[model samples]
Target: MTKTRRAARTAHTSARTHRVLLAAQLGNSVGDGAFYVTSALYFSRVVGLSAAQIGAGLAVAWGIGSIAGVPLGHLADRRGPRRSAVLLALATSVAVASFLLIRSFVPFLLAAAVYATAQSGLAAARQALLAGLVEPGARVGTLARLQATLNAGLAVGAALGGLALSSGTRTAYFAVFALDALGFLVCALLLRGLPALPGTPAVPGEGPRLVVLRDRPYAVLTLLNALLLLRLPLLSLVLPLWIVGRTAAPGWTASALFVLNTGAVMLFQVRAARSVTGLPEATRVVGRSGLLMLASCAVFALTAAGLGPWPTVAFLVLGAVLQVVAEMWHSAGSWQIGLALAPADRIGQYQGFYGTGVPVARTLGPLLVTTLLIGWGVAGWLVLGGIFLAAGLATGPAVRWAERARSRAAAPVAGEPVKAY
Candidate 1:
């Protein structure tokens, strides 16, 4: 084939793969939205679980899942990422279905653990699949597109879940759960349609079994990323509480802020990500995002000045706009830097280990953000701003350190010459 024809064929294939992945992401994200909305209610009202039980059980479940991710991702590396993703997606469907049969706390915990583990593994496997299919230059753009699709899917799913929430009937809750399970089934089928990637083989005496565990530089980056991810719980927990207890804004402003955040992400995330093409740019973007987040927190603090509802609403909206932009920048930068830093053969395990930061932030962020924003109030906001600024500033040094360490690791010992590709 001519070079032009070959390029055209490759572009066509990439587009097809991108479409399949987007469809699968939409399916799974819809299920995630429904579960996020309805799961707590189902546990308390439908399954006879106490609030304390639900909280503790879920924490333990997710903690287990976080630890399980590394090994499960290694399974993807040892087996094939596509096959592992398909299997894990099906397992998630089964675990979601098991929730329908649970009548007590123990069963709920078991089912939740299974679901969390499967979800974690599925994420790793899917990322590995993406890495294998997409070219290095195009991965971040594709990821941004997927992120936008995820936001759109979540909005649709949240709306469907809201209807179930409004009905407040057992059948409605069950329908939501059923829809969630079916969504995973659909995700698995969509993933199965994509081209398969074969397992990567290990070279003899290369390094430790799980190199990511011992990679100190990568660990530092992960920790820093986790700190940035504190924004996740800030949106879900702190902002709502701040609106209700600390600010003069109406309760509905909280919902409006959420819509604004998600909608902006859907519309502009890809554009935000377009400038981040490499590690240096990624670090720069993240650092700037930190400054933005600090400004956003400062804006949020102004709402408590008793400036009346209109001004308070204005401040809240402005804060949310800044916060969402910072979120998009941070997300875009992290995705690029994380993938850029990983070795091709171990992308699955590396991505899996990196992703542990999400659960870590989710677990610890609530306590940290609530303490700073809710308990401490204005001073707390300043402190939180400082924390984001510090983390963002630190990311550049961390990326450089990781790059140096990776280069050292790849360097040959005495008498060993490097081989050209």
Candidate 2:
């Protein structure tokens, strides 16, 4: 084939691949959004579980599930990401279906644990698959596009879930769960078409790969990333409580803030990620995200000053905007750095390790935000902002240290310096 023709063909194939992958992501995210909105309600009203039971069951289940990521990711690395992803998706579907039979706390906890483990496994495998599918340079941009698509799907699914909430019927809940399972099935089928790319084979004399855990710099990076993810609960849980108790804004303002955040993410996430093409740029983006988050916290704190209703609402909206902007940049920077720092052969394990931050943040963020940000009021906000600023400033140095660690690992014992592997 002519050079121009070959280039055109390759570009077309790449575009087609991206489209299919994005469609699968959108489908899965839509179901996840609906499930997220309705799961607690389903367990509470439909299953007739007490609030305390549901909370305890879910907490224990999630805690157990959080530990599954590393081993499952290692499994993906040892086998193949494509096959592992498909299996995990199927497992997730089964877990979601199991929710239909849940009655008492024991059954509920079991279903939740299964669901969480499958979800975590699926995430690790999917990320590994993406790494194998796309070129390194394009990974962040593709991830940003997928993130935007996910938000868009979630917005639509949240609306559907709201309809279910309004219906307040067991059938409505069942329908959402069923749809979630169907989405996972569809995602699995879509992934089935992807090419296989297994983990790198072990070297002759190399010991078993436990590198991710032993790498202190990477572990520190994961911890900081977890801290950055505190944005999740701050927006979802803390802000609404603050608005209702401390500010004059109406209850509906909380829904409006959510809509604003979702809309902003859908519209701006990809665009915001465009500049974060390299490690240095990604680190800078993370720092900038922290500054934005700090500004958001400050804006949020202003709403607590007994501002009038409309004024308080305006500030709340502004804070949501800033927070979502921070989210976009943080996500972009984190995706780039996480993928770039991981060894190609062990990307699955590293991704799984990095992903542990999500559960960590989800598990601990509520307590931290509720205790510090909400309990202490304005001082809490400043402290939280300071935390963001410090974490952001530290990201660049942390990344450099990780690079140096990699260099040291790659160096020969004969005092010969080697290029970073």
Supply the TM-score for candidate 2.
0.95
RMSD of candidate 2 to true structure, Å: 2.6
Per-candidate TM equals: 0.96, 0.95
What Cα-based lDDT does every candidate model obtain?
0.90, 0.86
Runs in model 1 deviating more than 4 A are 411-421
lDDT of 2 by residue, 1-421 (tens): 9999999988887787788789889988898899889988899998989988887787777777667887788789888999999999999999998999988888888899998888888888889999988988899989988988999988888888989999998899999999999999999998888777866555543544656777678888888898898888876788789878889999888888888888888888889999988999999999998999899999999999987999988988888888898898999999998899988877888898889889878877888989987789999998898888888878999999999888768633433432332
Q: Using TM-score as the measure, which candidate wins?
A: 1
Clash-forming residue pairs, model 1: none
